[model samples]
Structures are given as structure tokens and as C-alpha cells.
Target: MADDRRKNRIFRGSLGLLLLSLVLSGGCWDRRELETLAVVTGMGLNYAAQGDGYEVAFQIVRAAQLQSASGGAGGGGELKPVWILRSTGPTVFEAVRNATFQSSRRLFLSHNQVLIISEAVAKGGLLPALEFFVRDHEPRNTQWLLLTPDEPVEILDAAAGLERVSALAIVDLMKQYQLTSKIKPVYLADYIKTRIEKTTANTLPIIRIYETAGKKELLLDGTAILKEDRLVGFLDHKETRGLLWVLGEVRGGVITVDLPGGGKATFEIFDAIPKVKVEFKEGRVQVKIEIKERAGLGAQTTYADLSTPEQFKKLENLQTKAIEDEIRAALAKAKAYKADIFGFGEYLYKHDHRTWQRLQKEWERYFVDAQVEIKIEAMVEELGLVTRPATYRELRK
Candidate 1:
């Protein structure tokens, strides 16, 4: 009876220990509650005016204000949906951690949508200021990367027309880039890939503030060209689209051309495909860019019936010339900068490794003097509901 009693006591002790272990390991030890985190929607990087350190800006969405804006229980006027928190340090990692001094909750960056880099920082070098975002676990790699001549913090603080958060609004702008095909959207991962490439250069969309009639707004204006991780020059909207054309990223946009007789015709670009061939002849590098494009007659002020074969053929020719002109303009600017934003060097590396190996050392010099030929085949596939200009038809009647 005494031995049985001792066995029962040992079994009971083992059961108690097992229950305790289960209770201790049931939940995550490092789990944080939602209310303890400050959700960051946007981040901006700029140079600190006082020292050689960096300034980081975090746009934190105010949850209560956002709820109120969405018809939650709020009696008074709407409050600003985001709080712009700024901090500075000698390094980006330190700068990010310093934000905790001003913020009550831990800053969470998983939801960050956009990263704005100042012109000053971009001109100096992007890698130094961008190392933290690239290496950090919290910040996502898919966030849109933008460059701004204006203050990045100010850009984040600017008003968002539809979205309560300016970062998300900027995301929307990037999504609609296909509609215009004039802006190039670069993600953090994409930027990193370009930065690591030996022959290829990088470009980021330029965002700035526009004010009129006592109201301020954000607009994507142009493209910032980066060579060797430093800003070399910029491409205006027209030239930007030209770059997009060579990259075959043009989805939908309008092309307006003047007619030989009078007025102008607008063609809505339905699709565009580009074929680039890099040839090495007699130790000389040449690039041939051929573009195949399909468009429709969106609007015309000319009296000619563009639906007919003769008139349509002329229209096609004009469209082709216009596209070629854009491509040439972009090529001229890129060569002037001696920046290979077209990935010609990358193409050589992939297709002709031996040639790339020979020219890899002085690729920039070769690129500056390289011969580029452009050919465009544009077809106007649709003429819309009417054959000719409505006004012209009425006048004929």
C-alpha cells in the first residue's frame, strides 16, 4: 500500500509538470498587440541640414481619425488622418530607431506603401540612405520608390485628394501609370536589381508639389536618371514615354500629330512592342530599335477620311514618324548623359557574353559613341464610329 501511494504521487507530479509546460509554450513570447504598434504608411529620406547625418520621416496613420473619416462615431470636424514623424541620426537604422523617442507606440513598417528620396540624397548616392530599408525585415520590398526635388517630408504631408493617406494615394497614381505611360514606377526590389547591375542604369519617377488657387497637390512630373547609383540627369514626360517605348512598357496613351494640310489628329495607343538588337561590327557597337505599335483614331480635326486606305496609310506614316522622333529624343538625352538606361549593356551580357566581356570595361564610352537606329511600324487599327471629322462631314452635307 505504501509503494502504491508513492507511485501515485510521482505520476501526479509528472502530470503537473506537463500541464505547466503546455501553458508556458502555448502562445508566442514576442507577440505584440495591435494597439501597441504605430502603423507607418509612408517613409521619406533626406539629408539633415545641420550635420552629415540622415533625416527620416515616417507617415503614421491615425486610426481613430481614419475611423471617424469613414463615418465612425465622431461629432465634430474630421482630423488629419496621418502624423508625420521626423528623426535624424548618422545612419538610416539609427534614424529609424530614433523615431521611437517621439512616438508612443512601436513604429511598424510592414504596411509602408511609398519611399520618397530627396534630390540631394539621390544626387549624393542612394545606397547609403537606402541600406536600412533594403536590409530591414519590417519594410516591404514592393513599396514604390520615388524621387522628389521638393522636401520628402513635405511631399508626405501634402494633401491627398481621395485617399486619407498620401502614401496610398501615391500608390494609386503608380497603378494608373499604364493609362498615360509617361511615368515609370520603380519598386524597391527593382531598384536594387538595377543598382547591382554593372552595365545597366536606373530611373525613378519624380513627384513634386503643385499649388494653385490656394490649394496644394502632388504630381508625378518626370523621370530621374541614375548612373552608378547617382543622379545623372532627368527625362521629361515625352522623353520618359520614349524610354518606356524602348522598354516596351507603353500600354495606353495618346499620340497627337499635325497633318500636312492643316489641324491635327490624335491617336490612342492601344499597344506597343519594341525589339532591340545589339550588333558588334568591326569593333564597333550598334543598336537597332524596332517598334511595332497599334493605335486607333481617337479624334481628328482634319477633313480627310482617315478610314480610307490612302488616308489611313498617311496617318500610319505620321504616327510612325512621331514615335521614331520620341525614341530619338530619348536616345539623344541618354547618350548625352552617357547613361545606359535602355539596358543595352545588359542585353549584350545576356546574349553575347564574349562581346560583353570585351566591352564591359569601357562600356560607357562605347555607349556614348554607339550608333543607334530606330524603325517604327505603326498601324491605325480602328477609326472609331465616324470615318471623318464630324464637323467636316456636316460641312460637306
Candidate 2:
């Protein structure tokens, strides 16, 4: 027993010594000072004009700009919010290392909030360069991912007024869009998972940058369709809502219902809860989607009061039609793209694996011709007891 205890003590002593020696010898082998790095706020990747090459562009914020005293990504005091660094490499990681040639500090990615890629690169295939992203612990999975119609550099360079720098502005812009719009937020982790599942597909938010009067601005183009890992097509604002509806991701979007009179009434959705169901019957798949929502009347064109059940029913029917129309629009787009990004196939896989495997073989062909029926029913419970529908309602010429 004594000898056994002695052996245990020896093992502990040896481990401690080994750890101590290693810790003392390592000496910050990977250490790089903050000043040594450009501190990347965003990154953009494109195809280089060579064989198996890529152009990786970095959006870096001067660390001093991020410090409150130096006017970080939020202030305006003669400090640039972002700077650009570009390099060529065979892969994304190689491009990242090459960016260091122009900077004194190692690139910082922790604050990176948005990643924009060119449409060509995205259509070519994103899964290849994306592998390293997941393996590396530095880049976050929650960061917003956007694809640009133009070269990613141009979009990355667009100056936004909200954030001190363009990179931060894009991030802030995305947050605002999500908060006020019905657009679905696509993240790296979710995107990759959808691509890997085979039963599901993925989408990315698209951004377009334009310049006027020496200042850059951005626009949310909509959603890009992905098949396997390649972008097949894009969805417009209405189509995006359709996609969001299918995925049950609708949060808030203004819905305009053509009223019985001239002009239109705008209803802003406050809450949306959508449910999807998939079932097989008689050798066919049926997908049923249900969306329940509450909305505020943002505008009214005619004299109408919401205090009556008749008005509620009228608005409910109109909303249902409007939502269903959007859903149909989205369905038409997905069918055209022949990709089941809404994961209707995923629902099938969950319910019945045996059929899903068979369906997986010819999923594209089936999706192209498959019948996806969308049913939307919305109810207008209250108008918040409005004294008047709109200023125009009480006005007389």
C-alpha cells in the first residue's frame, strides 16, 4: 500500500513538472500584440484571376477607433471606422495570412460581425472554403453572412452612417433589418447544417452597395437560393417573405391590403407564429403551413373603423389572401430553383426515414413538380381602439 501511494505521488509530481516546464517554455509562441493586428471587422472573398486562386479582402477597424476615447465603430471624430486590406491566396486561410503583410498586428476576427462574399464565389460553391471556418475557433458561427451582387470588396467598402465603420454599419444594418423586417437571418452554423442535411437546403441574405455624393450606402437585396452549397438563384423582397413563411421565420413585415375603396391600407405585423407539417398519403407528400399573426394598422386610405367584427373579418380575410399570395410566390420560386430550402424534405425525413431516402435520390425533380400548398389565415383582433384610422380619414378638401 505504501509503495502504491509512492507511485501515485511520483506520477503527480511528474505531471506537475511536465506542465510547469511546458508552460514556462512555450513563451507566447502564438502571441501577437493588438497593435500588431489590423483587427479585422469583416472579411470578403472573391475569385482571383489565376488558376485555383482567390482574392481575400479584409475589413479591419483601427483598434483606436474601437476604443471609446478614439471614436470606435460608433462615433464621428475624424477617425476612419474601417480600413481595407487585400491579398491573394489559394484558400481563405491563406488569404488571411497574406493580409498580415500589410499590417503590423495579427488580424483580429473576434469582432468580425459580417462576412460578405461575391455571387460568383457563392454560386461556384461555398462548402469548400467554408470548412476551415468551422474548424477555426476564432470566427464566430453567429456572425451575419451576406452575398453581394458585385465584388464583395465594393460592398464591404460602402460607408454606413450608423456604425463608425462600414463593417460595423453592415452588422448594425442587419440587426435593424431583422428587427423591423420579415427577412430571415442566416448564420454560418445554420447555413452549413442545412447544406449538410441533404434533406434540407440553405439561403443567404444578399446586400448591394451604391455610392452617392462620396458616401456609400447599402440595400438588402433579399435572399439567395442555395442548392447543396451553390447559390442557384435569388429571391426578391416578396419571395423572401414567402421563403420566410415556409420556414416559419416571419417576425414582422408590413402587409398592404387593397381596400374596398381607392388607395391601400398598410398593416404592420407585430407577431407571427408559423407551423409547418408534412405528411405522406397515397404515394404523395403534402406540406401544410399555418401562420397566425397580430398586426397594427400602420396606415389607412379610406374611412374605416376597426371597432366592429365586420371590419375584423374583412381585414382577416384580406391578410390571409395577402399572406397566401406571398407564400405562393415563394413556392413558385423554390419550384423554379428546384431546391427545397424550406426543408419540406427535412420534415419528411423526420417523420419517415425510409421514404426520405428514396425521395432524396430524385429530390430535385420531385421538388420541381411537387405540389406545395400554403394556407394562411390571419385575424385582426383589435385596432388598438384608434380614435381615427389615419389623418387622411378626417381630412376634407
Best lDDT among the predictions, by candidate number: 1
Report, for every candidate in turn, its global Cα lDDT versus the true structure. 0.92, 0.78
How do the predictions measure up, each by TM-score?
0.94, 0.87
Best by TM-score: 1
TM-score of 1: 0.94
Candidate 1 residue-wise lDDT, 341-360, digit = tens: 99999998999999999998
lDDT of 2: 0.78
Residues 229-290, candidate 2: write the lDDT tens digits.
89898888888887776666667768899987666778888777788887766667777788
Give the poorly placed runs of model 2, Cα more than 4 Å off.
1-29, 66-79, 390-397
